[model samples]
Target chain A: MVNKAPLLEIKNLRVHYKVYGGVLKVLDGVNLTVYPGEKVGLVGETGCGKTTTMKTALAILPVPPGVVVGGEILYKGRNLLAMSPRQLSNVRGREMTMIFQDPMAALNPVFNVEQQFTPVLKHAAKNHLSNKEIHAQAVLALQDVALADPERLLQAYPIQLSGGMRQRVCIGMALATRPQLLIADEPGTALDVTIQAQVLRLLNNLVDRLNTSIILITHSLGVVYETVDRLYVMYAGNIVEVAPTRKLFSNPLHPYSQGLMDAVPKLSGGGISQGISGRIPDYSHPPAGCRFHTRCSHVMEICRHQKPPEFEVEEGHKVACYLYGPKNQEAAV
Target chain B: MSEAILEVRDLKKHFVVDHIGTFRRQPVTVRAVDGISFDLQAGETLGLVGESGSGKSTIAYILAGMYRPTQGRIHFRGLDLFSENGKRPLFLKKEIQIVFQDPGSSLNPRRTIAQNLAVPLQIHKPDKNIMRETLRLLELVDLPAIYMYKYPNMLSGGEKQIVAIARALATDPSFMILDEPTSALDVSVQGKVINLLMRLQSDLDLTYLFITHDLSLMRNIATRVAIMYLGKICEISKGSEFFQNPQHPYTQMLLSSIPVVSKDEEKLKPAKMIPTGEIPSPVNIPPGCSFNTRCPKKMDVCFEIDPDFVEISRQHFARCHLFGQTQKQG
Candidate 1:
């Protein structure tokens, strides 16, 4: 896996949203990578720019309000940001696709399943396939997601389907293109726990069988712990920690990561945790240096003034915190 | 043991909806709460756990007197709730207060925190100093008195929920119904709220009918846990036993399916029970067992007859043919 070239590489991605008072610096020099057939989890709370990063990667971020100040979203060694409209469209649904948190919003309420599938299928196939061929593929996709009756579902509207079924249809539609990479932003968050578990299992199986890479964005630590191999912990628009799922859980280096892990209520009975104190920083005037320094427990003087560089704590485990830097080590000694 | 603070017996709530798509305009009955029974002891948190459309919210509404039950009876401290008339007595209403999910909507956006808190205080404690009481409520929830002047929109999601909790506390009720209280908040914020609720439970000696879909959360907070499926209780047990020895197949399935953070927690989970199908519609629930369509260990009898609640242990009860038949044979 280390030797393999990354399927998607986001380098120094800086995104800003033009708001009323000032430009909200949503993504401040964010960096992430997804290797082929790798399951990566981007975990963060609300307004932490996890969704913004993914939306930017897919070129779906609404412009005028959203402006990419600086970034390079590289897919297969080619920069996605530099791609023309036609080129991006050709690569969008066919090569890489996204599934949103709300399936209802992603799907058209007026259109039946068949009508919804036709355009996506046609787009994926580059308009080469006939209507009948697309219909057959749609049925197969629906079956793959374990939706019982493909014929009945294809004729039904989005409103008619249950939340779980609607999500399944969305998953089926997203995977129908057989994209190399899939970005699922809280795909099962809206569904019930039982239904969420089922959907997640189905997603895992489908992605595994297809040998496709996935970037699962969710706030639930448990969900990420089970699904992803590697995790990128984002806090206030910065990738604060990046490590293997097990390693991150076992020995989290960053204060925010540790706080996040401790925040979740565990099933193995323990008293409720004292959750991280303070809210996410105001993005419009995000704290300088370490954005997490405002809430971090181990806040050094230099941390307040200087942005901490990503330090490799161990092999494949990186943390962006001054506590792990040379200054802290010398002080400790 | 202290007397049960609240008792529900054979409680049922059904809603009749117009079948719009069909040729004939026929109404379909959605059996939201189908003959569920439970007893909430004083100062004990009874966690009502279930999935969406499982009628957990309907049960909460019924208990809070927001909706009348289609059938059955509810007794609060030995006094029958429905014995009087359509309107609950003002004193009874004061005894039962509820905190709802989505505090953003629950707290009136137009009203300031002080005003919101004053509504319950003014209603329940009309003679008390409203200003002083509002500040006290704020202090109770760990928020500063300065926040009393702030509008709901000015406060964060967690702060708003705290305000809602304070409002619920305003009535000085012994029984509180928390309907998915912290589900809408962030994970980091959830802990603070849960800790506050737990602290308040001990401080106030409050009996909570906690309703939520997250079973893992109930493990830490609840004294007793009840699993609801399609408006019926499938299993009920002490909190420790609910996690350690989940009896019903549906319970086992729900337990196994929960995604745990650590391998140690994973080890404690029941063996993976892959649920087969999605939850059936409440309007068209399966003939026999509601969970039969999804239960992996379902037997032939599960499809033919609804099993009775078998007392698995001293206090643990499971409604499943697997246990029902075992008890019969024994």
Candidate 2:
């Protein structure tokens, strides 16, 4: 996948922060690639850099304390990290649109739907269009998310809408440009199960229709199973496992991945999925060797002393754990 | 079974809205728990299912002696719980407990898990050795004895929840109200907590007033379920029977809307009935059936007169006009 032409290739990405106490490594040597029209689910609990990874990719991350220390974000052969200010701006929103986790917070309270929708269209457009054309585009954008009476909704404020509707609006605004890649960070969390399903279905339908790639960052395995074809399981700012969704669920190689799967509440009658026992390691001074060793049920002595090299489990499945091979032992030696 | 542990008759708890408008103090009554009646068996888990502000929480709080009902009779062991002249029963306070939604909020932040769990013991059974009892409660919820000395902030969401459950059980309550106990927890943690609750129920012979919005989870654990909508019980039936063939339109819609992750199923089966729009404000409830505003098969009569609950099956009860007519005809 890395050898092939990727829609977005994140190679050895390292995002860090300079706090008063110390330098915090939030994203350490992360590697991921999404081919054209690929739906890759980035699954992890809170503070696992799932959100940070997406935000960094979009170049929208607030950066005074935060800094991308090293990385190559190659989108369509162009290295985004090396791009000029104008070049970066041109690619962002127009080429790869992003939707935030909380729609209510993301949307402006003072502005109506029409006000927010206009700027997005104007920004996406290479040349200025007529007011009629802009209004039509705005209505169409709302309709794209399946909002009833798009014209009426366009006139309404964000406060007038429900949480599900607000999320739909956010999705609509994101898709207004028809970007090559869509980065959704916990877009469906605020919604109810039914509404969440509707939003997810709408997203999938949009992606399919436009042939757009999507990076869905979620905490729920059920959502990942439903939405994504491939999954990247993160633990303590490190990519612990990367595999196809079915394979990851069926033959979870990493102990952390297994713990996550076992922790999720399943609809079917199986025993309780035991949750990961410990909290995510503090980023300012993360543990040596395997980042997940502290919580890993099958933690070996090598895991404590040495960082596990990426081991190829099977086709399209890779795991970072000492228990996997002698390569880890050799690294430790 | 054992003379009905708690018998609620026409339980109606309304909130008076004394908002100053153009007119003299506008007295708008929010009918939180509108005329409802049910009984809890000695050791049965009665699941109350509803979306936010469906008055499920209100009902639970009222039952737990937190709020006084405006109009109703809560007869617990032949004594009225809300009567003006009635003495508040000691058993109602001690023998009945609650586990709130957010374990973080329920447990004190400053206090250690041991201290937090020991509060109920100190309040109820003051004579008992509090530290010894706290360790036993912690063990009961599967929390390690070491966590007893740790503060609530030091614990994870799941651990805090375990501590909350331990505190609730400290008084050895025969009946408990678990209001969205697992809603705030992660899935795996939720499963563990639910399993713990199930085990505890069987072991302690506990009666539960389980309130939740998760239909799938309710089906797994609840013995009997009461579907609430806009401060009213749309339907109440045995869990098995309710899942098999729900009588009310709202109940059917709610059950169908649950996301099925099993690969055997394709296309999230949309609720056979999608209730139109959002729930109407309880403060300004519509005449007749409150659900009529969103109900798909609402009739003119449904808008004019309130529907009376009719027993469709042995234990299946619903408050739709369709069932009302069948009851009159039969």
Candidate 3:
């Protein structure tokens, strides 16, 4: 799997959202690569730039307010950040698609599901699809999500469906394209655990069947652990750690990553877990060196003045922390 | 263990859904909280967990006296809670409080923390010094009294929730209905809130009907847990045994569906038996055994007759026909 050429590579991606007072440095410098048929989870608390990173890479990040200060988002060797609006449109839906948390809000309330599926069908198809073909494709997509009655559902508006059904419908539209890459931004936030399980299982099955490279962006540790093969932990603009899901969960090297693991309420009957102390750093006036140093338990003098260097501790596992010194240093030690 | 402080029996809340079409309309019934029975003991936290449309929130509302139950009897301290006899006794009103899900919307943005706290204090304890009492409530929740002057908009989401809790405590209620109190908070912030809540409960000897969809959270905090499905209590068990050995098929599914922190733990996975189906609309609940349509263990009896809420084991109750086998032995 590591031998395969990467489908998506976010190299030193930096983003800043200009607010009223000053520029909020949303994403400092994120580096991630997704290979074919890979399930990668991006996790962080709210305001940690997970959404911004995805939007920027997908060329959907609203500009003017959202400015990519540096770095490149290379999708299949082509730089996504450098693409023009017209050029980017070619890859937007067909090559990649993103589903949001809110299904009703993502969908057109006034139009029926059939009408809503029209644009996706048009954009996703390379050449052309007849009205009948489009309708059949939409039905097939809905059926793929295990919808009970796709035909009747296609005729109904977003309001007619339940919350879980609406999300499935959105999933139907997002996947109607057979997208090479699927970016699910907190897709399971609104659904119950059962429905969420269904969604994850569907995604898992679809990925295997279609070889779709997925970047699942969510805050749920369990969702990330179960669905993703590898995961990246983001904190205040930077990706703090990246490792295989099992390894990361079992032994997270980064202090912030460990903090996140500790915060999760476990059903295994452990006492109430202690959350990390201190507030989330203000992005507008982020700390000088490591943004997390303000809250880091084992902060050093160098962590205050200089950024902690990235350390490749294991194969496919990387961490940005002073505790590990720097890349290749641990091996020498 | 302890005398039940609040006893709810055969609770039902139905709302009429008007299906509007250009030409015609049809009236439908949405059975939000139907035939739910549970008892809240003194100084105990009863975690009520269910997905949306499961009537968990509706139960909270009915408990708060916000919505009158279509049918049911709620006994609080051996008195009918919502009787037509009067606008509830002041003591009953003052003894129970509710903290809503969204702390942002629950707290008035225009009002200062002091002003918000004053409203409850003014109504419940007219003779108490408003400013002094507001500060005291803040301190009890581990917040500095300095936050009293700040508006809800200025505070963080967690802080706003703390302020909301402080307001709920202004009346010094024995029972509090916290509806997903920490759902809106960040993971780290959620822990702080949970710790604050636990400390407050122990210090003040408060009873809480904690309504949340977070099962892991319910395991850590609840003394007893009641699982809900389609407005019915499916399983009620001690928190210790609830997750360790879930009886109902739905509960098993719900528990299994919870994403485990590690793939190494195979037991964390849900039983791979239940079919994936959307929770049927409350407006059109199934005829018999509301869960029969999607239940993996559903039988002919389940389709024809609803299962009785039976105790399959000591202090563990489940509403399922499969439990009947154990019920016979028990």
Indicate the residue-level lDDT of B308 in model 3. Answer: 90
Clashes of each: 0, 3, 1
lDDT of 2 by residue, B27-102 (tens): 7788898998999888888999988778999998998888888888988777687778755766668888999999
> For model 3, how does the per-residue alpha-carbon lDDT over A1-333 read when each residue is reduced to its tens digit?
878999999999889988788999888899989998899999999989999999898887898899999999889999988888878989999889999998989999999999999888987775498899999999999998888888999999989888888888888788888889999999988788888888778767877788889999999998888789999999998999999998999999999999899898887757666688777788888998988999988897888998876788899899999788753355558
Write model 2 residue lDDT over A225-330, tens digit each, in one string: 8778899998777898999888888889888888777665433434454466667888998999888888777888988988887888788899888777866557
DockQ of 2: 0.37
Which residue ranges in model 1 land beyond 4 Å of their true spot? B19-26
Q: Runs in model 2 with CA error above 4 Å? A: A1-4, A322-333, B1-3, B17-25, B144-146, B264-277, B283-289, B292-306, B321-328
Residue B121 CA error for candidate 3 (Å)? Answer: 1.8
TM-score of chain A of each: 0.99, 0.95, 0.96
- Give the per-residue lDDT of model 3 (tens digit) for B260-284: 7854334654667544687898887
By lDDT, the candidates rank as 1, 3, 2
Question: If you assessed candidate 1 against the hidden native complex, which CAPRI class would it receive?
Answer: medium
Better candidate number, 1 or 3, judged by TM-score: 1
Give the TM-score of each candidate: 0.98, 0.90, 0.95
Clashing pairs in 2: A262-A273, A263-B188, A265-B187
DockQ of each: 0.77, 0.37, 0.65
